[model samples]
Target: MTLAPVEYAVIEFGDSTVTGDLVPALTELVETGLVHVIDLVFLSKDADGTVTVLELDDLPEGTAAAFAGLEHDIDDLVNETDLQVEAELLSPGTSAVVIVWENLWAQRFSDAVLASGGVLLDSQKVPQDVAAAALAAHLASLD
Candidate 1:
């Protein structure tokens, strides 16, 4: 099955902040058919942030196991090392979510980073060429 392309917002916060909201939003996105799953990348200040991605497969009733199969399809099409892989896994029907925690959401996390002074960065959505290159590169490296 072909995937859909979607857009999402990522909320970044400090250590041990309000991270519970992400799952529900992702679930909603999946339920609405806006996206199959969300790739959650966590960015933090000086602490050296690590990106952790979770595909929301616990879909609401009525929908097929599309998300269940998506993980493998995405993994096959995109290289694990490429950032675009996340975007590629999300079909045109799906979208990528970039959660950057800041004021209003996580004051402590926002304040801590500001005190130390860290900036949030956004990676551009996977363009066609970039996605193609990543796929091509993955295929080539396989040999």
Candidate 2:
């Protein structure tokens, strides 16, 4: 099947528990058909710098149940190397969730581009702070 672009993000909760609070927002994205969850993995680093990786089944009963709805059959797309690279960014006593998702909203556009023989040369996500600064500058210029 033709697929849309897939992207992954690692969200870190410094020195905190991985509460399933973000589940609702994620559920909304999926339910809205904006994106499809490819894989999700949880990681934590202890005070001694020991890293632990947890899949859905490895999470606590409550946490696991909360995240259960987000799971799809497309698993293991985020491998050990991917987890390790993200884990290195976590501080001791911090936890993170790595989520890989298909940009379902862009599927049609991507398919059309392919059909037209167009190629994607590059893509980049601007940092939030930089985007905010640029917006502020533009607003100031308009004043």
Candidate 3:
């Protein structure tokens, strides 16, 4: 069967701490367009290593290959820069990022994300109205 296109989002929060309502947000995203909910990734890093795990209903079609490249790019940027970020993707269509702050690394991260055919939705860096719309749109999908 033809799978839905993956939509990704990287919500970069200013707090740098994990937030709740992720599931709800993702639900909204799927309900918006005709896209399927693919893999959801949480991009966090600590002393141990980087955390880039999926958190959505429909897992990405080509997760292994997509994530391999994503992992490499994420590692390189994190090691060379300071970006507390989180990434979430909705299969072939969209992705969002939440970052502590905006910096040059944003471009690099954006490139990596787009390369994977993901959109970079930096909630922290983006306008409040836009975020609200996204959140609202995502939430409305619950119905």
Off by over 4 Å in 2: none
Candidate 2 global CA lDDT score: 0.89
**Tens-digit lDDT track for model 3 on 35-94?**
333333444433334444433222344433333222111222232122232322222222
RMSD of 3: 14.4
lDDT of 1: 0.40
Cα error, residue 73 of model 1, in Å, equals 6.4
Best by TM-score: 2
Q: In angstroms, how far off is 34's CA in candidate 2?
A: 0.3
Q: Model 1 over residues 53-98: C-alpha lDDT tens digits?
A: 4333322232223233321223222233544434333333222334
Position 99, candidate 2: lDDT: 87
Ranking by lDDT: 2, 1, 3
Which model scores highest in lDDT?
2
Each model's Cα RMSD: 19.4, 1.1, 14.4
lDDT of 2 by residue, 1-143 (tens): 98799999999986657878899999999999999998898999998889999888888888888889985657888888988888899999999988889999999999999999999999999999999999999999999
TM-score for candidate 1, please give it.
Answer: 0.30
Report the C-alpha displacement of residue 81, candidate 2, in angstroms.
1.2
Better of 1 and 2 by lDDT: 2
Give per-model TM-scores. Answer: 0.30, 0.95, 0.30
